[model samples]
Target chain A: MDEKQFRDYLSSYTDAEKALSAPMRDTIRINTLKIPKKEFMGVSGLKMEPTFYENGFYADAGPGVRLGATWEYFLGYMHTQTLSSMAPALVLNPGERDIVLDAAASPGSKTSHMSMLMNNKGAILANDVNWERGSALFSNIARLGVLNAKVTVRDATRLGINAYFTKALVDAPCSSLSQPYAYKKFTPNLSYEISKTQIKMLFSSYDALAEGGELVYSTCTYEKGENEEAIKLLLEKRGSASLQPLGVEFPHEPGLSEYGKEFRKVARVYPQHFSSEGFFIAKLKKGSA
Target chain B: MSHVTTFREYLQRQFGAEVPKEIVLNEQEGVIRAYSKTLMMLKPSGYMGFVAGKVSTRGIEVKSEFAQLLRNPSRNVLALDEAQAKAFVESESVAIAEQGEGLRIAKFGRHVLGVGILKAGSLHPDFIGKGRKRVENSINP
Candidate 1:
């Protein structure tokens, strides 16, 4: 809302490097299993670093680099995914034969990564609402040599409640507030007007996930109103689901109580802390087995 | 399932030929299972969805789309216009060669999807595993 509140809003973040400059574009993960590290270097001719936690290579999208049309990418060997974006899939740990759904998968970075991690052994339904976006998702999945994936064009909120999945990933569409370039008016105070759609899609994700199934809800935004508060409300509607803790060593900022009890297990990554975009993640296990 | 038969009939009328009886049409799931000496999976639009990931003594593991096509290859070839049929046949030939025999062909249909040289005359199906060196013909053929 204001600079003071913005400072206080991020006060809990331990690595509040208030002086740091914002990055122009986010990092991307190159699928190294198909394109080996050595070959990736040769093709992009760019220095690459692997994220410590996942099998993805990160490159700065700053200077004269066209990542999409390159040979490595056209062959379906790489996806532009953020480091923190990889966390929820790891948290979900979907297995082969398990039915997985990615509710908001467009330009499919995490969806392709999950398919490979599953070793192309399970069914992954990657759904996106927009026709153009869904087509883009399908193209990326095809380029990756994925055989066990299916694409659907539908409003994720309308994916029937009758369906069940071993695991679900809802990278819900949220306010891009955490992006440094977001207009000042996008803050949580404006949540009433802008966040309504996100709130609806998030609940729809929970409805689509089956009993005893696990859903990892994630958003790139850092605000409690969108992340923790949404989880808290969803937990209230579906009491059977509860939050699970993250094992990765990440910093926990203080005074974020606006999200209530559910915030304890939720994980947040700040731009200052992870050298990446701000992200919020929470893992919820559905009905007990 | 009736959608498959209706679609098959419509195709037969359009092409003026008897559709193959073994075609298993599944329009509801948006997939088709076609069975012959080999299995083919097909989508409603007659596109090959997948090929058999495995070969079996009993039945082949047809992909979702080709499994639908195997039952009525004629209806499929006829489903497209002469130009499209020719293109489909060429593309399918390449896909089948590459997938079933590990032979990459430079052209499929009118467009070229890759630059694989055709194997010397009468390329043995046995040469399929040559794409990967570690694979040896240890299994009795």
Candidate 2:
């Protein structure tokens, strides 16, 4: 999808066009497990504002200071992540005692976040299919002082685990349409193929979830085929799962209701509207057998 | 494997730090690793594939990747000031004010950057590893 083509598809062409070229804000989330938020904020030369999430902040990175290179980051006291990417973990809200599964965790931004949320108390099965990325996941997990997580190299759709998890996070792989340069490579066939894999991953995630468990499915794409349609297919195939409303307060539009009433309960974030990257998130609950 | 006792004895002789009872050390392909007992459960389920650290021929050396998991360090510690810490993290050796040392933890403020070595009254930051360059650049800048 070219800029013109994408603009024509948007609800407001002018705002969307402007947002596509807008500068992305630098945001960081304080790792409370490592350092207190107040003390980290006291570091000199940092000017920031509270993000939608309490632990996150939108900061003006000083000249020549790479946020990733800071001492605080080295200590794993903070993580450089986009505000939109931080939502899925916030929504999942894993507890200290819950056994959780990060079905497609790699490079471990969300997995580490879940670890902090869990206070490194329970077990987290962090899996990624790619070996190279799995190494990065392990490194990040270790750097962040995350002990409860176990790194695994396996396709999430075929994870042969005998035990069920109380909660799961599926930030499924999707077409990178939300990225500024992604539209150049966008194709109908590619989108269709990704949607199919996404649907399969969703089913697998639901299968691994224990009864009364909650799963948060999210993606960084604006394509309905890969977002709502995939969830609709999962609901149709799995009789034991249902979609639930997300009660968290964040800037977002309702998911396309044309798909279904339950789909409307899902949240859609557009870069133009939220001043962040495009994203879709839906909360799911596995009913008792 | 066969070197488990040797490795334990090495740690005791060199650093005077006891290998904790809860830490299970396993050797694979000539590399020894230390892991918590809980990791055993994940190993049986095939959920964990990576080891925490490696024990070298010299002594039980912790891999940089798992350095954060080391709750206790050998008494040899050198605290660096902001300037010295930045210089040390840039992979540059910096002069230390307080004398004597061997393997020391390089700390900047409250954050532990990793391990460093002190020889000839100068601290070598090679232990910061390749991954920690980002921290050096950001904090030092």
Candidate 3:
């Protein structure tokens, strides 16, 4: 979007600039696959406060606390993540017995989080289209002691079919509208292109799910076209697809019904709302036989 | 802790490290990996699963990812004091006569620091993966 349009769009939110530009506290999701959350909460040094979500924490240890530099982090007991980003995995809630697909997984924040959610049981196929990102993804997965997820550098839209996965997550990439802190390079044309790709990824994710399984389509960007529009298109094209209310409870806006009434079930997070990042999440269930 | 398999057999013999049998171990480009059995069914194209060890000129050298994955090793452990523990996180070498000449699990208190080579009475630790420890962070040596 252009400057005026962008400001107009952001104008709806309270303290949009100040909140988005503000530096957020580091969020640590305790890797229960390694160290139990309760035990980690007892560890000293870093000042930790629990979030509303289970196992999510706001961690700080003075200036330059370097949570990333601690043995606890390196040993895979914890992973540094944004609180906003944690919501997708929590919403997906892949169980120990379910096979999962994480399309467009890179740097593996959500993918590894799903691995932890699965408790290292069942399986996950984490695919990223970029080679460099795949390396970082594998690094995070291995470092976090995530053994249930496998890394693949390939176009996520081309992944094998057969309704294999019980659950799927497409945290599709988008322009950094999520973080006004580092937000740039947003244009109507670019957003349209990206939205197209997001729809394709969403379709692939839904198709990858087994009949009766669920698919979660999420993006860091909140543009109507990127978030609600993508889901809207999926529901229209695939009659089997239907929006499901996010069983997850976190602070955020309800999805816009502009696309359709069911879009309200989608979760839309605005950075200004809680000084978190902008994110959109929607849970969809595939019709079963 | 009981792990004696082809990928990390030497570690089992050396440090009594335990690797679960459920892992489908495979060696890719000198590094040994343990993949999820269910994930392996898809035949992923790029990197997959956890790294167990590496194939060096001498033999399989189990890395710190293995220790971190397995968490605790039962034997051949070299416990480090404050000064030595500092050196371990910094990836430095310090002399320790406790463990015999070979690779041992370097420990600072009860936590595993990774696999270390204890040869000629000196220990060199390697905690593989991103985000290493800050030297300022202390451990009782």
Number of the top lDDT candidate:
3
Tens digit per residue, CA lDDT, model 3, B79-131: 77767877777777888876468777877776676788888888877665545
Model 2 steric clash pairs: A69-B134, A69-B135
Q: Per-candidate DockQ versus the true complex? A: 0.04, 0.36, 0.48
> Sort by TM-score, best first: what order?
3, 2, 1
For candidate 3, the lDDT comes to 0.76
lDDT tens digits, residue span B36-109, model 1 = 21112111122121222233343222232222222222321212233322333233322222222222222222
Stretches off by above 4 angstroms in model 1 are: A1-16, A19-26, A32-45, A60-63, A185-190, A249-255, A258-262, B1-141
Output the better candidate (2/3) by TM-score. Answer: 3
Superposition TM-score, candidate 1 onto the true structure: 0.64
How well does candidate 1 reproduce the true complex, by DockQ? Answer: 0.04
Task: Compare the candidates by DockQ and give the number of the best one.
Answer: 3
Better of 1 and 2 by TM-score: 2
List model 2 lDDT by residue over A80-149, tens digit each. Answer: 8888988998898998778888889998999889878877666688888888887778667766767667
Q: Which regions of candidate 3 deviate over 4 angstroms?
A: A1-5, A12-23, B1-8, B38-46, B97-100, B127-141
